[model samples]
Target: MRLMRKSRRARFWMSVVVAFVILSFLLSIVSYVWAAVDEVFVLSIDGAIDPAVASYIERGFKEAESVGARAVLLEINTPGGAVDSALRIRNRMDESPLQTIVLVKHSALSAGSLIALAGDVLVMRPGSTIGAAEPRWVIPGSEPRPVDAKTLSAWKAEMEGTASAHGRDARIAAGMVDVDMEIEGVKSRGELLTLTAEQARELGMCDAVQGTRQQALKFCGLGSCSQNEVNMGAAEHMARVMTNPLVAGLFLMVGIALLVIEFFTLGWGIPGTLGLICIGLFFGGHLVAGLAGWESVVLFLLGVVLLLLEILVVPGFGIPGIAGLVALGVSVFLAVGSVEQALITLAIAGVGAVLLVILALRFIEKRNYWPRFILMDRQSSQEGYTSRETGYDRYVGQQGEALTVLRPSGTALIDGERLDVVSEGDFVEPGQKVRIVKVEGLRIVVRPEK
Candidate 1:
């Protein structure tokens, strides 16, 4: 009986030990898996670089840092973009905490190339080309002119500073900006060279020529590193699309159409409200996108003022209206990237306005021909027509004295009956005797009795 009890106690102790060991092993596995699942955030930059792209990149960096990402890989494939926007993006990248690696999948010419040099590490594909970043202006009707010496020098300094920050050959980076630059022991005699992946590695411009992201990760001492794709959601994607210049231009056209319809209808209602909202959204998007500055806003306001003058003070759509449109067009062009986009927007707005005007005119004509345009329980009395209760049977021939200065519209007293009247083309001073010349549509037309 003593041996049986001792055996039972030993079996219980052994089972406890085995269970503890299994639990410890399972915890170790979970910890290992957690460590291995560390992520690297990716930011893909394709096509022309702009404020939209810059914003996207900046936002991506913030998110990566928030999630404790291991690193950020900026996959670059751009022709170029606005210089100011590029500089802003470069400055942001320089200030970022996470390690930034620019992966040149196909190419990184011009502004794209500048962005790559700003990265902590640059990875390129074997057959990819990079460089030719000289600044040139695309003047209308002429070939692109090389930027002036002063501009070139400033840009070269900026490029060199950015390159040196990332432990790159600053001189080579500067050469990319000034095509006339030549560095000794770097390029063959008189050879205008754009760096290929192999040449970039030889010149220490790129760390490695990798065929795929996996290879890039391995080469960067992250052989076991895992990755998570950082992507924009559906709402973010739609926001980005609406912020585009083309989409904003379309909105402007729709707004103009609504405004034209409201103008012809002679009342402020649904069309006017929709027009105001659309225009507000159009300007708001541009403002948020950083494409439009305060200058554009000021110009747009000035144009509005001029257009009001054309409508109220002037008789025809002459100088004021034309000038207003011109100012508005110039403002819009300056707010966008290029002249082509501006012209496209103008064409669309014009077509939409014409169609809206035609529709409005037809509606007005139909209303004039058809009675009961607006359903009403009672018909309103006509203006300038005397009611039978007034006892003014002989008022049409009786003279009246102007009670107030009739600079187009004021009050008059005829036979002790006060009346609101408007002068026809001439000013009528107070105390002047006036005659009721005509009566039409609630307006009493009066003139000075000669």
Candidate 2:
């Protein structure tokens, strides 16, 4: 009986140990399963929906899928952005495996309206507006105006295509692009169709109306899911700013202005350094924004190096300087967009820089900034700076033999002494007879003996 009882006790302890092991395994797996909970990712489509915005949204969708998100929500507030960027966003939305839900928090004008339509379900906030999706072309220095008929027709078709793909009324989207489309109830001739939240829902354009973001998500059957908000990094923001035509022009102007100032002044000072930095930012920002690339930057840098060599070592503005200027102009114009845009941006920046520099020189220089930075002290004999002056005036009218071939300036043997001399607009070979004609300070001018 004692042996049986001991055997029973051992079995019971073994069973308890096995149970504990199973429970621990289950507990570990529970955390993993919990971590795989449903997610509703929200990305803020704020400001101008440019290339940067499209890139950010594309990345957000990728991340959402990696974690098996339930749905992707876009919170939009924009007065439109780039047409290409909007189209890219629309393509991405159409291809995404997870459904997209767009919540229009404010205005969805122009490109914004097209992006909002790309979603599986579009919810609008109360009293918010949507539509007015005409394609407007902006020349940098002038006002923005409508695109030409050929371009306008193509844009109208694109809008209609996008709307039709999502089962919305094609005519309604057409009215947004072409003012003369004349939708019977929503729009008339010579007028673009812009709809309020209520009107959008009535026209079958908007899925529903919700006051808050949370309510909108709940309506989409994604209530209680964890919300993942995708935010923009600092670099992205800078890139977006650089994509602006005016901003890009400003960057180029500042860079060029500072560089000019540096060249005119002595030594490589603050202006030169700052100019380089601004130029770098100009290129870097455009590259990040996908407007320019490494090739443009490389070309620009090569041009600058050549120009610097010409200025600091070669003594004149020759091939390198001209090439550098061309390269710089090409690179800058590339960053600012099309020809009209580039011209406008350049004009604005150039005019503004000239005005600002003039104002600074005329009035602002003596105040605080320029006065502190300017080096007023002269380098003279009293200040411990001196030149070699071995009574060079006495050498005038003296005959000499060229010791070194004078490519305008070389050494010559004068009165049994070697002296540094310069020819007056002539090249003299070695062993040639020469006579000193002028002397001022330490400079002694010579001419080949006639």
Candidate 3:
């Protein structure tokens, strides 16, 4: 009986030990499961769907795929952008292995509409607008005109086909591209169809309507998932600025002006360095954005070299200079890949350079700063000037006041002496500070003092 009692005690202790081990193992498994948090990625794409935006979306998709995300959210808000850029973005989204849900915050017109259709699921905010995917051909110095029937026909077919693939209304999609396409009760002739959020749902184009991105996650059954937002990097912002029409024009003008200044100054200092940087950015940014390929960059470099050779090696504005200008213009046109864009840049730079030169001559020339940098000075006898001012050389750097308005000819008060002076095209008000840039006998060329 004593042996039986000891055996019972041993069995009970063994059972307790086994139970404790099992409980510990279950607790560890539960802890691990709780430690692994769910993550969802939000890819925010706003503004025009240019190459920069397309590149951003591509990078966002790759990053989302790499992280094993629960869902890839496309936060879209744009009016529209380049057709080619939009198509590239659509292709990237279509090829992504991860599920992509397009959440349109505001208007998704034109290219934006097409990209929205590429997603696995389409959604929009209440009262948000979408559709209007018409394609128009733009010509420089004139209003935009419609494309040929064949091109329009092809685009309409493409739009319809994309919608059909997603089980949406093909007729409605085609109507967005062709104004002639009437949607019976929804739209009439001579109008491209744009739909509100509720209209999109009724038309079976959009999947759901949600106000914010969190609501979208909850709608998708991933409400509790942690979110990761993808954003533009420094390089992407630089690319956007480089590609912008206004900014690109400004860059071109700055480049041209700086180079001109460098040539005039002839010392290759700050102006030369700044000029090179502006030109480099114009080429480098476009090159990275896929707008300017290596060929355009090569052509641009060759053109710049030829222009430099003409200036430094030949030392004259001759045939080489003209050829260089042509080459550079052609390269810029190719780099931007459009005639209209190229003309815009050229016009802005041309006009901007003139204005800049005028301002520099007016405001900066008075400081005698140009003379410090330039090696030569001009002498005009017709304006009443001599090579050597016998007694007026002492007044060369003297500061004085304009006693009368100078419209290339004025009177000045210098050292309490009334003297007749000639201004250099800068209108100087009476009582304004004046500096003597050149003195020839009685003709003193004065400018507004810095």
- TM-score winner: 2
Instruction: After the best TM-score superposition of candidate 2, give how far the Cα of residue 7 lies from its true spot, in angstroms.
Output: 22
Clashes of 2: 1
lDDT of 2 by residue, 1-450 (tens): 999999999999999999999999999777655654567888998888886787788888888888767889999999997888898889989989898999999989999999988889999999999999999986655688989999888878888898888878888888888888776667779988999999999999989999998999889887787888889778788888877777877887787778767665667898789888877887887777666778888877877788888676553356788988788667667765556666766676678778756665655465755545556677778879877776888888989899876767778999999987889979798899999999857778999987
Of candidates 3 and 1, the better by TM-score: 3
Q: For residues 29-116, what per-residue lDDT tens digits would candidate 3 score against the true structure?
A: 7765543337777887788887778778888888877766767888888988777788888888878877788899998898899888
Model 2 residue 363 distance off true place after TM-score fit, in angstroms: 6.7
Pairs in steric clash, model 2: 141-344
lDDT tens digits, residue span 1-450, model 1: 999999999999999999999999999988765653577888887877767677677788888777667788888887776565678789888888888888998888877888989988899988987887877765334576777899788878887898888888888887777766678876543444478999899989888899998888887876577776666545445445555555766777778778766665544778779988887776665565566677886887788778879776664467899989888898777666457557766776667667866776688677773232333344347544444453344466668999977777878998898988788868888899999877654667888988
Model 1 weakest lDDT span, ten residues long: 369-378
lDDT of each: 0.76, 0.82, 0.82
Clashing residue pairs in candidate 1 are 383-442
Give the distance in Å from residue 409's predicted Cα in candidate 2 to where it truly belongs: 12
